[model samples]
Target: MGIAVNNINKKFGQFTALNNVSLDFPTGELTALLGPSGCGKTTLLRIIAGLEGQDSGQVLLDGEDASSRHVRERQVGFVFQHYALFKHMTVFENIAFGLRVKPRASRPSESVIREKVTELLELVQLDWLADRFPPQLSGGQRQRIALARALAVEPRVLLLDEPFGALDAKVRKELRRWLRRLHDELHVTSIFVTHDQEEALEVADQIVLMNKGNVEQTGSPQEVYEHPTSPFVYGFLGNVNLFHGRVHQGVLDTGGMRLDVPGHAEAEDVAGIGYVRPHDLDIERYAKGAEGIVVQLIRAHAIGPLAQLELARDDNAELIEAVISAERFKQLDLKEGETLVVRPRRLHVFVDQPSHHNQDAR
Candidate 1:
């Protein structure tokens, strides 16, 4: 089911939770509502599920008005951060509860329900544990069962609110890939709310970034990551080194290093605050690049094939970071406080506005 939200706004007492947010969640696409705490991602998801009413605007499902629909009428499968399965109920019973208790108009026959429940159990790979209670299962197993329960009802849309927030790092990583495959197989229109930037980038087909109860920017993960529409988007999307500089002689210069940004792109646009990600930075001791004094060297971390170097730039500048291979670092004989050339082919320049100004705001 394709969902089209137009002019949607929400308010809580004196605070505005959402301000004229408009978005299109195309059918079969997994859209992520990503932002910091109190950003209203949960509020938006509630509005879609009919749990919270919007102050104004419309929610159109496949071109039909659904704003006035009841919560049960929306038929959205919701998964919460904490698994809400009944402890005494077995996996089969928990997944079967939704269908068994649904209204007569929506409920299927006993045989049909049995078939559907069995199918969902298999889909989530918990069929053998049908008789097992919630406490008998691992966190990942419980999550899978929760997903199975939600899917058994065959919802028109799927909504997840930090579904993996309670799991450990390894389980969360594994579940993300599993969810992507499940979405592909089911093709249910879905929206996921997350505060983790990496989760948003890895899981969503489109990302909606929000701040202060308002939408900041909405785009594909790559589009938002590579060419952020606002400074907040740049900072919130990934770990980036920010520089304070300006355009001199039609050239963009940051910390005395000239960038190759074209004149048409507005050198001063990001002049006051230029940005570069860890992957974009290069490290070498004074090899004709962005020169800076290393005031501090952060603890090195071994992240698979790459090594991360976090450096405190001189003069209280934002932390400069670079990701390099351990082998390359050994060859260069890297050390603490050593000067390095940090040159990147691409940099993002936000217009010289107050740091508070963002990409999309009411």
Candidate 2:
């Protein structure tokens, strides 16, 4: 079932942790709560699991109020970053712990518990490690066991708090793919908190990007990356080149150069900012009649398939970076300290108005 958080607010003493946050996690879909540390992603996850109470508003599980429900009654499966496995118990026992500890009336019989534990172990691909102690298992294996334990209770919703955070980079990547496949097979409504942009982009069907106490934007990976709604969203999602200047008569003058910005007549007589991604910039040899910004190349590094160039504006020495394919770099044959013309294939401009309350706000 889907989960809905409506107008939720939370605070710690004088500090506001979450401010008027509202979100929807679609039924049987994996959603990622993504943000930097202290952005309330973890706090929101805890609140949904009934582990923490909100100062205001409600959490609805399939349209039923779940705010007052106890953690166990909520039927939420939670996995933490650390492998909270029992050092004294075997893998099979760890997965059976949840079922065995249930109230007598609801607890499964001993034979049933063993069967269920066996199934979960097979599902997590760790049946071979059933008799191994946690200390004998690898980091990835322990995490998989932890997830199997969470699923043993047949939770309605799964909440993972940086579940792969303790693993190495390669292991983390592999586990994310595994988790995605597991979700597909089970179709459980799951929400995981991650500070990693790549993880959220790769693993989630929907993404909620939060900063401070507010959600900056919510969309699929492609939607958010292609069309960022705010400056913070653009900056946080990827690299961006910024141009600050004054706009007049559809032209922006940065004191060093002027850019012709058509269809921006309303921005006349106001300060404006322009943003362009490194890949959107086109570089070429400077010609006398060339119509583009002139910049001097500082250095060029060809690493793997992409070549990165460090450039500086000729007039004010403001630095910029451009990334292109190695094939294009070889064709251009760029040299250090040489003047080059740069044209932005696409640009996003916004009035230079910063919001005091929401820094990412337009």
Candidate 3:
């Protein structure tokens, strides 16, 4: 099922949670509402689920208005971060609860419920744990059971709010791949809320980046990451090395350093900032005469296939971060206190704007 929110507005006291937000979630595609906490991603999800009413605007499900529908009447399955499973019930019973609680006329027979629950358990690859209690299962197992319960009613739409947020890093990684495969097989229109960029980038077909109660940008992960519309989006999407500079003729001059800005060559000079990803920087051992910024390496951390380096500008002590492949690091034979020159291969220049500081993003 497709979901659409039109001109949605909501407020609490003097605080506005949603600012005339409008978006369309494509049919049979998984969309992610991604943003920092308190950005209204959760509020928007709740409104779509019919658990909270929007102050204005309409909620449409499958092209029909669903604003007046009750929570249970919406046919939306919701999975939460903490795995809100019933501790007192066995996994099988929990999955069967939704089917058994339907109105008498709609409720399935006992044998049918048993069959459906078994099918769901196998679908989630936990049929063996059907007899286990929620507390007896691992965190990952409990979350899978929660998902099974949500799917038991055969909802047309599924909503997951940080479904893997409660798990450790390793388990979260595992479940992310699992969820992506499950969605591909079912193709139920699904929307999940998450602040983790990697999760959204890895799992969702579409990404809606929200900020300050407004939708900032919407696109596939590659679109947003490769062609960010604003500085906020650039910084939020990945680690960026920001250069406070002024643009003149096609060059960005940051006091002691200057970099080429070919895209702005024909435009009038203006104060701007340059954003470059850490991996976009090319670092080399400093020589008597180097063309790029000279810096002294402060630290190097190599993990698996990549290495992260911390360096301070030789002239001003400005700290910079650079990411290079482990093989490159080995080629350079870099060590702390070694002087190096870094040239930014790609630079994105944006007109100077006040920074949007999110405690979580930093």
Candidate 4:
């Protein structure tokens, strides 16, 4: 079912947790409410699930107001970060809890509940562990059981809040794909909340980025990642080298380090800030008289696929990070406090003076 939240505002006394926010999620698609902690993603999700009421707005399910509905009546299956499985219940019992909780008139027969629980267990690839309790299961397995429990109700909408955040890095990555596949199989409209930018980009069909209780951008993952609508969105979504300067002849003079930015004619002589992605940065051999100096190497980590370098950029004394293959890092022989030439071909500039319309345009 599609969900439409109109001008939802929530507050806890003087703390306005959610401002005048409005969003519409279409049916059967994975929508992500993405933001850092305290950005109100969880509050919004709870409001949609009827766990908490909005001060001023309507929660509409398929164009019908559902604000007055209770959490149990909303038919929203919630998968929390902690899994939240009952320790004493076996996987089967946990998955069957919801069905058994309903009144006699609404509860299914014993055979029906068993069949449904078994089917869901198979769907989550956990039928083999059906007899095990939550403590006997691994973290990932427990989460799978929690998911199976949520699906037992066959909820119209699934709301997942950091469903895999508590797992190990490798397992979390695997479960992200698994969750996407499950979403495809179920075709249930799901809204997932996450603070991890890569997770949101990899999993969700559409993304809504919020900041300070306001909707900053809503688009496809690539659209929002590639073309961030504001400085906050650009900085928050990924590592970016930000330098405040002015544009001259369509090229930004970043404190004498020149960057060619096309289609920014009006920014000449106007103060602006430039952002360049870490992957877009090029290492200049020390002798080429490169634009940037490695003022500080904060840390270098071997994160499987790439060796990430955290360094201080000379221009504006801002910290910058770069990710390169092991082979590349070895060829460069980069060490702590070694000056390297870093150049960027593309540019993302923001007009500083304007309150709005600060975007990352190529």
Candidate 5:
């Protein structure tokens, strides 16, 4: 079943945590609520789970209102950052806790409960650790146990709040891939909240980007990355270089360099800003009649497959960065203090006025 949040609003005293936020989580697909801290992602998640009440609006689970339901009745499973496993319980016992706690009339028989726990342990590939206590398991192993426990109850929807946050980087990466595979196999409707962009991009089928209690954009990883709808979206998604200038006709003049803006329909002469990602920047040795901005190289470092370069505009001393392939860097043989012409292979322009119109890459 799908979940729909309609016109949800929440406030904590004078501060508005969520302002008229609405979103749809498709059935059997993973959705990620991605944002910085204090952006209301967690608040919205809690509200959907019936752990927090909304000031206004309703949460619908499969087209039925679930806003007033108790957390247990909602049939939603939650996994937090910490494993929250009982130190005294073995892995098998921890996984069986949910089933055992059910009312006697609804509880499964002891033999059935044991079988279910065994199946869940095999599903998580930790059947060997069934007898080990949480204190004896590694951080990653503990998280796997936690997820197995969450699934033991057969939740209608699974919600995870940074479930892998406490693990080490290597473990986090490994678990992300594992989780993606697990989600595909289980086909459970799941939503997870995280501030890590890479995790969202790699693990989720849909991403809802939130900021300041508002949704900036919602799309697949590639859609949002290739076509950002706002300056905030562009800046938040990846490394971007910003240029402040004024637009005349279709040209942006930054006092030091002019960028040719083609197919821009805005007729009003106004200040505008331009954004170009590091990989979109092209660098060449300076020469006459070159159609690009002239910049002086401050430094360059070859990191694995890419070379990161710091450059400054000759006319205004504006700083920008460019990342190029190591092979290209070697071909150019660039050095510190060398003059180079920089051009954007693709650019995004936005009008800096009362109404900002974001121009997609062209």
Candidate 6:
């Protein structure tokens, strides 16, 4: 089922949690609500699930007004970060809870419930642990059980709030990949809230990036990462080097280097910032009259196929980071204290504005 919120607004005492937020979550696709804490991602998700009411605006499910519906009425499955499984019940009972709680006329028979629970356990690949209590299961196993429980009633929409946040790095990685595969099989309209950029990038079909209670950008992972609409989006989505400079006649000149940015080609001079991802920087051994900024290699780390370098610009003593293939690093035979010339192969320039100004009033 497709979900949408229109002109949504919410407040908490003196602070506004959401400001005119609107978004469309296409049917049968996994969409991620991504942002740092206090960005209202969870609040927005809650409102959509009918757990919290919006101060104004509407929540629509399948093009029908669901803003006034109760949580039960919405028939949405929700999974929390910490597994909220019943401590006293066996995993089997927990998975069967939702089905068993339906009104008598609608509830499935005991035999049917048993078959459904068993099928769900196998779907999550945890049928072997059906008799174990929540405490007896590992964190990852418990989370999978929580998911099975949520799916018991066959909800039209599934909402997960940082479902893998509590797991170890390796477990989180495993679970996210599993979640993606499960979504493909079920084809349910799903929305998950996460602060981890990597998680959203790897799992979701589309990403809705939020900040300071407002949606900043919404697009496929590649689109948002490669074509950010704002400085915040560019910086938030990944590691980037920012060069503070002044733009004059389409050229942005920092103290160390300059780049042609025709997009901001106004004749008038203005403060701007040039953004360059570390991987986009081309590094070379410095020559006496070489083009690009000259920097001294301060640190180098090679792990697997990638090399991460830290350099200090000679002119301003500002730090710069670059990433290159491990093979290239070996070819250079780089050592600390050696000077190198670095130039950005691509640049994105945006007018400088105070970040605090984008935030809503407290």
Q: In angstroms, how far off is 165's CA in candidate 6?
A: 0.5
Each candidate's TM vs. the true structure? 0.90, 0.92, 0.95, 0.91, 0.96, 0.96
Q: Note each model's CA RMSD in angstroms.
A: 3.8, 3.1, 3.7, 2.5, 1.5, 4.0
Model 5, 1-362: lDDT tens per residue? 79999999999999899999999999999999998999999999999999899999999999999988999898998899998999999999999999999999999999999999999999999999999999999999999999999999999999999999888899999999999999999999999999998999999999999999999999999998888888888888878998888877677777657777763556367888889999999899999888778899999999799999999987665688999999999999999999998888888888766464566545
What TM-score, to 2 decimals, does candidate 3 have? Answer: 0.95
Q: Score candidate 6 by TM-score against the native.
A: 0.96
Count steric clashes of candidate 5.
0
- The CA lDDT at 225 in model 1 is 85
Q: lDDT value for candidate 6? A: 0.91
Error of 4 at 176 (Å): 1.4
Enumerate residue pairs that collide in model 4. Answer: 284-341
- Scored by CA lDDT, what does every candidate get? 0.81, 0.88, 0.89, 0.85, 0.91, 0.91
Q: Write the per-residue lDDT of candidate 3 for residues 1-362, one digit (tens) a residue.
A: 88999999999889999999999999999999999999999999999999899999999998889999999989999899988899999999999999989999999999999999999999999999998899999999999999999999999999999999989999999999999999999999999999999999999999999998999999999999988888889999989987777877667787657877766665456778888889999999998877888889999999999999998986674588999999999998998999899888887788543332111111
Per-residue error (Å), model 3, residue 85: 1.1
The residue pairs that clash in candidate 2, if any, are none
Please give, for residues 162-213, the per-residue lDDT of candidate 2 as tens digits. 9999889999999999999999999999999998889999999999999998
lDDT of 4 at 360: 43
Q: Give the per-residue lDDT of model 6 (tens digit) for 42-80.
A: 999999999898999999999999988889999899999
TM-score, ranked from best to worst: 5, 6, 3, 2, 4, 1
> After superposing candidate 5, which stretches have Cα over 4 Å from the reference?
315-318, 354-356
